[model samples]
Target: MSAPSDAKHPPPLEHAASWYAASANAAPARPALSADVSCDVCVVGAGFTGLSSALHLAEKGLDVVVLEAARVGYGASGRNGGQIVNSYSRDMDVIEDKYGAETARALGDMAFEGNRIIRERIASYDIECDLRERNLFAACNARQLQGLKAHQALWRRYGHDQLELLEGKAYRREIGSDRYTGALVDHSGGHLHPLNLVLGEAAAFESLGGKIFEHSPVVSLVHGQTVTVKTADGRVHADRVVMAGNAYMSGVMPALEGKSMPCGTQIIATEPLGEDLARTLLPNDIAVEDCNYLLDYYRLTRDNRLIYGGGVNYGNAGPANIEAVIRPKMLKTFPQLKDVRVDYAWSGNFLMTLNRLPQFGVINDNVYYAQGYSGHGVTCTHLAGRLISEVMTGRDERFDAFAGLPHLPFPGGRLLRVPLSAMGAWYYETRDKLGI
Candidate 1:
């Protein structure tokens, strides 16, 4: 009824949806799991990765079933800044350094393919998700602009030559903001109504007769020749199980707990400004992100509201005053919007591996798990799902290329890792401020 209901009460994920949710044209919720069920495959966590995996496996005619703790898109998939930027948060050279040149090339291909999958799915499903294909990487100053220039070479070397440099008159004409000294027009990356896309894919999976169980959280996992997933209401005994629980994963897989840590990122959406004013504030309607490591990303919705996202906390508890803490940051970038009121603010945790690389691997052979998207989950999840299904079906080369990358646990362990990581963040924040 009110603007902030989705964030203030933070409706139970299964019952609540975000702005994207309000616009979704999806089928009603899948029935809850009521009793023990058997299938050829059981995928845990029904976000984009889980749903995508289920879709591919089902298309192969495998009797696959998906189990979700909350409603679909309850995690980062629904709550992200929605910018589908092309590069992995981790460096491509890291893959080359740890794996090999070919492996790095393959990884780049996967990231590119991930973007393709999003576009192909939208076209095939005829789903309406307010999709857009424009992005701006706004640089705060000359120093940041240099980084973008170097990145341009890296992207070019990988055969991605779509980005354009924007500065001065050109930059202001594009974004209508003087906060950025330069900007990168990200043709390869863009934004979308994330939850709608996730739900739409979930519907596509079911249209093919794949089963989905919502409000059914996986409590424990048994991995082996035959994988078993135990949920609160039922257990799915299957030939294979996939752990797509990106950030909210807990006892379901102890081995993965320390492989990455979750950091809370919060977002607020402004009340719908009329289209005319919204256009004036952001002439291009392109998704905008700054050059800072801890950055602010904002964009306009189809209905003409400002969806602003930034601010991070390693702890699960949100900022003491999310609205108060985040609003100032928004103003620093767009001081002209001092009178703009925040309509809603909600937060979610995103997993970050030590190297900022995504963690994808098998636990006990048949029980596969992939997490640690490091804020690139929107597109990477699609690729993760496709690779998981390929491996399950005996196509190992592509999957193993990614699985071979080493993922070490956080040094201090989960109990102490949060604060340890927070302190590390403080050191970086201090550097970003002093222009180190």
Candidate 2:
């Protein structure tokens, strides 16, 4: 399979105009590929996954070259809610029920590995990404609250003890909102400045002798004893290739197109609400995401701005006015914020698999790919990079565990998958409304 090269294809270049970009730390624009290069490993996509893979491989003294379609973290990695929620989009109970106890156990152990990797990178490299250490899953109705209870019990059985359940006024204390009936807090989970974190990781990778090329989209990938990845003006011949491009890969691999559909999620940042107001809105300053099918996730920025995100477009097209679509949800969650001014609004696409599980596997003998993190890519992507590196280093047990998970394609073909998924989501959304 080859990357798309057409006039309509967006060029791999600048970062999106997001709140993250406005306050991003200084990082020079990397040069695009202009000449052929050879490496032990070639990584496509410089988001969290690619950067993590490159950093890990370079740490092992491997020759690594990463080719990015755009600037580092130009996709969902840079534009997500930045919540470090452990586990997949689907809960462990669902996985256990569908796959079995052993499979669920293996995945459960890996669920928190990504969070550990992120914290280690931040401390080891001293990357300043406003790293925090708490996240809450708020429940709006009794059914959702019951699910949280079951979720906490399930995690406890898996030896996870950092969970704390809050109810009534205690829930209100944790999150300064009257909307939640109860909340489950994960002390191990947290949030960070996602774009800055990715950029810092890229720098760390480069410092370890890993090469990175920005604005170099993979036009074709030729698999063989030594895979060849070609860009518009250059090529990379490597012992192995890793396809880390999620939703933004276009048609790079025709086989991967149907396994997941790109879904658009939008976010809006409110103007600085002052320290007092911010404190009042989020008393503990921890990230929060509801338990609904179409969830609303949010957190307070370092500058005291409310970074609220929700509203998914299953068709992959962004709303005409992102602020308009998100503002109502924010107002519903925190009525006092109705008068707050929106400072920035943006949208990005995440790969949503049919079963809501990430897709990870090898394309051939040496070409590997991992995608379809749903909306949980921030942490899972880091884990993916580690898994890929481990697999390359002759450690395939953990990698195989993820690779064994089944990933089904959408019911309809690519042309109809978007609308079909949208209709399915509507049904679930209706069920959530009915509290069923």
Candidate 3:
């Protein structure tokens, strides 16, 4: 572990536009990386991590250039469930059971800080993304209910006493659904407009004079004292580079492409239900997630639309008709939504490592990367960016904790991991049916 330094971490520059492009706070697009450029750092992927690294480093007056294949926020950072959740995918108790209480405490603390990282950014940066402070951790079954109970107790041991375990009417009141038997109300976690958040940070990064190139996909990198980042139309000479592409950097970096598998998550936005029905649907406007591996995450959009996310698939192929695939899932959760029209339906990929914990670290000290937040990218990516910035300068303590967690690459390599995962998913679904 090294001390946090003041170096900028830049990736390959990209040039283009996106949905975020349509709604970015103040996007003064920069010219493409047309010629060989020299910079203190180059960042790849204008998503949370890359934009954030650029922001922090440029704040320190470093010459930073960010590269993205598409426009910023085109990847999982913009498409996630907007759940600013704590704890890694393995859960706190699993960490405690396998690693011990001390390590579990560190894990919980990091996750808790992941929430704080977001809150601090919203306030400090004045980001307006329908920010809220309600998070309902739900259990779909009694068995899951017990696990949440244990999870609450373990988190409490870490001094998070404010976490409230709600059941019965309390759970019903916290969320509008009786389908969930119990829930943990994490007042600290919340929901937000993710694309806006990423775009806002990009604005802040530019404010500090960071250079950005859109539609600039990094085709190759030559590593040495100074990293040579080559994009199709341009090149960058920098002391350090950061890969923050997450699920979108397909084939850009050979070593990272297969490390994390991408799974498609679908969402259905109901036509405006009005305050009356929206209040009945989710009175508290709390973001919710179930305990099932394939979970349903939903929240009321600022305009009173039920933004329901569900049906995760382990293939690159998106559901041809997202409305058709998600409407049934929504109706199952809220039969009252039978008459509700799904105004918008979309699906996006979320990368998940086999270990279930997020992957963050310096593939090389001068070259850092962060990904595999599972479905918890909103807040985790913020933390990832911060830590990667720290690693870029010299700090390495916090980054090491996450990097220390073991991550196993999918077996059968590139050719068959998807099929294997799909088969395993079917088995889990079958078990769900058999009550196993």
Candidate 4:
């Protein structure tokens, strides 16, 4: 139940205490890297990006080694809302408007590819992460409902047609809450147990002759033709390096230091409500997220527990009491859960960029990294891994589309970035309240 002492450079540890941790399948501790190793590619962090990249590269007959700061799926990859939401944090319309139609077309083509990869990996590897179908985007006000309409239209323009609009009492067919004015159901989007998925992917990667050293936090990278990735106990000399560490990484690549900031979100799981009540709460048993600037997302766990999560801390700082911060929000949506007991509460961090899109680029022609997934790491991270692998294998067209996008350092640097971003969030949140 111990928290990570250093958020940026978390020490080697077990998974955070949460519902996921309690129900996680058995996984033995991986050995720490104690001897110098050499490989075709050395990936940092065993979360989604690293595992996905390692698995893809391993399948391509390359020798891949993954080093984890903690256990597999230990970061946001393991702890997110588990919804397979598509698209980047900044959707395609914004990309097209800001970067141009060519960039938008390139990204739109792969908007849903990440979730597709998730399902494919699950079926191909027989991963049991409680995969489910359909996800709903709920709207609390007329403005947000109209926004959902535009969102559906925007997604359709990108060729994703598995959507249906629901309004009035129809919302109850999906979510029991009366808070939503309408909802958009994405038949293609879904949810699953995140930790199990990544763990299974890691096992699948190892099956392909990939090696992962847990408790091996990379302390520094000596970049050259052959990158030397140094950890506390060992070093990995490789032809290429994948810095897939995301938010938990710091001080390794100074060039990447100020471009993104880590932010925390909290989640709480209520005691099992049993099948009937659980079904009543989420009649269709799909994940649902509100359409707010700072949104709330929840889903019924396989065990029937309501897992609700929301709220953000821009500075990567977590609330002193997670349940205290989130319980009221849960009650505001589902007051019927007045007497329900919270069985678990936990917090996790995700890297955020100024533009809200993921930052993908290579360092020194060999050190490739894809981070700053903002709040959309679940699907994007998987896609990033595939793209990183593809680019390394000489297929850079799709990779360049993402890498070509611009990412800038936060305007106020580390010290003021948190407060500045907080102010922006507050402004948007106020607009949400005013139903703008």
What are the TM-scores, per candidate, against the unseen true structure?
0.94, 0.97, 0.91, 0.97
Instruction: Provide the overall lDDT of each model, using Cα atoms, as 2-decimal numbers.
Output: 0.80, 0.90, 0.77, 0.92
Query: Deviation in angstroms for 29 in model 4?
Result: 1.0
Question: What lDDT would candidate 1 get against the real structure?
Answer: 0.80
What is the per-residue lDDT of model 3 for residues 4-109, given as tens digits with 9 covering 90 to 100? 2232224433322323233345555555578999999899988887887788788777899999876777777776667778766777777778767776776677
Q: On lDDT, who's better, 1 or 4?
A: 4
Task: Kindly indicate the candidate among 1 and 2 with the higher TM-score.
Answer: 2
Q: Top lDDT: which candidate number?
A: 4
Better of 2 and 4 by lDDT: 4
- Which tens-of-lDDT digit does each residue in 293-408 have in candidate 1? 78888999988988888867885777866778778888887777789888877778888888788888886667888889888788888888899889989898888877888888
A best-first ranking of the candidates according to their lDDT comes to 4, 2, 1, 3
Alpha carbon deviation, residue 235, candidate 4 (Å)? 1.0
Across 91-169, the per-residue lDDT of candidate 2 in tens digits comes to 7889999999998999998888898999999999889998888999999888999999999998888778899999666
Give residue 207's lDDT in candidate 1 (0 to 100).
88
RMSD of 1: 3.9
For candidate 2, the TM-score is 0.97
Candidate 2 lDDT for residue 328: 95
Clashing pairs in 2: none
Better of 1 and 3 by TM-score: 1
